[model samples]
Target: MDQPFRHIIALAALALPAFATNARAEEAALIDGGKLLLTNGVTTIEGASGGGLASWATIAGRGTDRGIGLSTHVTLIELPDYGWQSHGVALGLANRLELSYARQNFDTRDVGTALGLGKGYRLNQDVFGAKLRIAGDVVYGEPLLPQISVGVEYKRNRDAPVALTVGANAAKGADFTLSATKLFLSHSVLVNATARLTKANQAGLLGFGSNGNDNHSLQFEGSIAYQLSRRAVIGAEYRSKPDNLAIAKEDDWLDLFAAYALTRNLTLTAAYVDLGSIATFDKQRGGLLSAQLAF
Candidate 1:
């Protein structure tokens, strides 16, 4: 198997052991799984809990205000000229603090050959993220109040040499995000909006910034969802990306997705995504599939 797939399998193996270790005398108190179905939000490409393509203000697990929770996910995206894969794990503490890790591998099929990087070249990156819920609640706060969160993500590109060769100023960078999310039970609707400060190019797959333009810029991520039932939701997301690389033009991303809870602990999501352009390849669109398990 490929190294990245092996790493994912190893990470999956740790989940059961870790959960078992925590299921001691205080198991009931720690793993209550009290949150409503689908309220925890699905995992993002960066591994934080949110919409399929955008980050939301919701926390990561099914834990309530007093319990701890764990979640893991694997996501795949297939494009005409590229393929994407990511897997990660997350820990939620008392539904207030969240920590996550995700590794993304972008496969540059024939496009790599055109770019003189050999066919099937792959770019890999690791993302480490942390989020803190500052105030309010996603489902129970005042009608006008929404859940608010602040988060930070530090990304490291594995192919630093390639990144630098593409005129990127650095192979690593950090991003900050402020998000707000609310679920209106009466209307069966969920809404989210996030503002991000970043300088990463192509979501950091190509690199961070460029010598000519190396400043962070404000970006936006918005989502609106309608709950079809207690365990199902359909939503659309829009994420604006910065064009910080002079070598290539980047475009915003959009997706229409549906998520369903197959079981209390397992949720499945599918989406059609439009990732405008990547490395000068325009009209890059694809389908996304993801599965998340939480407890």
Candidate 2:
């Protein structure tokens, strides 16, 4: 071969590795490696990211497939004449099994007096819950499809005598919920639906036999969300509760929320909830704010 031709070939070969390395770096830079905020119906679960309180179904599994992590939430709910607050944390082990513990404080603003329970009677309860994901993926599969999960919660009511008089059936009980979620890649939407079977007396802490009712009923919950961007999402959800007590009529609520991803390990969510009404009680509407962290 000619001397000049040999030199040209060697030079081209020397530049090949550099060109390949640059190409690989560019491809890696295009991939969004941060956690993705995913939602289904009223439930919001961590995607590639971790956890935040949005209510609804979320993508299952914790990390990539090597280990597990923990998700914690502090939630507050405000009603027209009453206000309730809950504080709890959950452990997501291997993204397969989840265990959670929560404490709820129910305060009677003025409704307590009408029920003859006094000025302010606070009812606190401890709730323990577990969830398992049986199918699907949120990271690698279709952007519009989601995973499925089955879970149950055991609640222990601590409202003693007051609960006996008003919510005579306010005892410990187990509630089961079946959840299904789907992510719409084309529209950037997430949808979720859930059905729960629960008892009337044990679920209603005020009293079951108020007007002569004592039984259980089925409840339905759903939510839909749209991804505004990689870091923001907007969604809404509805929950139907049973009215086992005659003194009050149970009603469902609608929620609108917007969430922001702060970092790979943290997220912030804000929501507005509207609880129609219970009997003559005024409609309850309030705001909810939550922060979540995962590792």
lDDT of each: 0.88, 0.56
C-alpha lDDT (0 to 100) for residue 238 of candidate 1: 98
**Model 1 lDDT-worst window of ten:** 2-11
RMSD of 2: 16.4
Per-residue CA lDDT of model 1 for 1-295, tens digit only, reads 4333343344344344444554553546787899999999999999999998899888788987667878999999999899999999998876777789999999999999998899999999999887877788999979989999888788889999889988899998878889999999999999999999999888899899998888999999999999999989999999999987777889999999999999999999999999998988999998999999999
Clashes of each: 0, 19
Residue-level lDDT for 36 in candidate 2: 43
* Residues 102-151, model 2: lDDT tens digits: 77777776877876667676767776666655567544476645666666
Question: Where does candidate 2 stray beyond 4 Å?
Answer: 1-35, 38-62, 142-145, 200-204, 207-215, 278-280
Model 2 gets an lDDT of 0.56
Stretches of model 1 off by over 4 angstroms after superposition: 1-28
Candidate 1, RMSD to the unseen true structure: 6.4
